[model samples]
Target: MKSEKSKNGLYSHFRLKSSMSFLMALLVFVFSCSESDDGQMQGPEPVMPPETSMAPDMSMFDDEGGEENRVNTIQNWAYAAINVGVYSSILYSHLIVPVRAFKVTINQEAHFNEDAGLWVWEKSFEVPSRGTFSVRLTAEVDGTDVSWTGYVSKSGVFENFVWFDGTSKLNGESGKWNLYESPENPEAWLSNSWEIDREVGNGNTSFTVEKEGNHQGSSITYSIEKGADYDRTVLINDVSNSNLVEVQWNKESKFGRVKSEAKYGDEMYHCWDEQLQDSECP
Candidate 1:
């Protein structure tokens, strides 16, 4: 009987140990499920570097000043061309190279900017030869106002060079132009040559003449008239020598038609359409 009782005790002890182990496993599984149901597992958040505190560089602004200077240079040259054209036209109209005496009136006030070193003037006047002429002048000032005056002879020589008080961007510019008959025939009176100089800068930004021509047919007359339809008409007639050229331009369309007839050539017509395309006379 004692032996049987000992066997029963051993079996009971094994059952209790197994039951305790199973309960422990069930509790562990339940804890894992609860953690899974609660969104994601919690941990420390990642860190980022501190923000910087520095100012931006300002060297880019310097280029703007340089660009403005370049624009001023271009404006100065453009104005110079206008002034030269006006003076040349006047000389041609009078058939006088010396330009003994003349008067110029500037209707618009001279545009002067002391800080930017810029000056601009625009005006229109009448010339005996050119009929009516308009002019514009822009100048750059280093210390004083820049100006120049020159005279061209009938034989295409530059004389009486005069420099104004100021410095000019075209100070050293010089150009010569000649119109000859043809490459082979040298004997021709229907040709002329002229030279001009802008007594400023490097003097290389102008036209040059390699040969001279001798064409003295007759005095050329130029007339510019404004039309009723806001159009402009330029008539160049040398009727004494059988040379005539007429140009008409629309103000809004900016289209132009040119008809030219010369003593030595056939009649030619050209047109610039509204789209700024060049075509046969329309």
Candidate 2:
């Protein structure tokens, strides 16, 4: 009987211990599940996607209606009208002759006028930018090929007289003389002749004492040197009505060459050959 009682007590003690361990494990599992649920609720509020910045469009500037296409016409300058013909010959590739000296290039529609004409273009040109440019002029004169080389020094200024013969000697006298249409080949004239107080006489050519009413002072007598060269130039005593001066020039061509007659206040200057002419400046 005592053995049986001992065995029963041992069995009851084992059963109690196993039931307590199971209860502890169940409590731990419930607490762990509750903590996991709390962590999930606290996670960062669905991160609002970072706001993206948009770039402004440039489509408005690309409009074709507002576009402008400019027209460009280029005038070439083949040479720079230096005051010296020797210099011009060196600078220009063409032969420097007495005939092809003073000239300038103009646009096709331009025409030269005698009145208030100070080497200007009849029609103006629009320059795209300022820079040195090559200039050339070509014209068929009676089937003869005539050409000139020059340059455009200024963008706004029209290409005018080359600094050949006329510029060689007469930078001071430039703009003081007038260029007119000549009856013949050289095709230009200068007027305004007067008599000076200085006595200039030659045995060959006679200066008749006559009243020059337009001259502001007393009529003076002076003679130009008599020769074939002098035959082309007319002697004058005054030019500006106050100063005594001599006017000398010939007709446009070699054959019909005669001393130019001054009509008082009119002075002649060579347009095409002024660059090859003698310099009045020392």
TM-score of each: 0.24, 0.16
lDDT of 1 at 21: 94
Q: Compose the digit string of candidate 2's lDDT tens values, residues 7-45.
A: 999888989999999999999786654334324211111
Enumerate clash totals for all models, in the order shown: 12, 34
lDDT, residue 197, model 1: 31
Best by TM-score: 1
lDDT accuracy of residue 261 in candidate 2? 32
- lDDT, candidate 2, equals 0.26
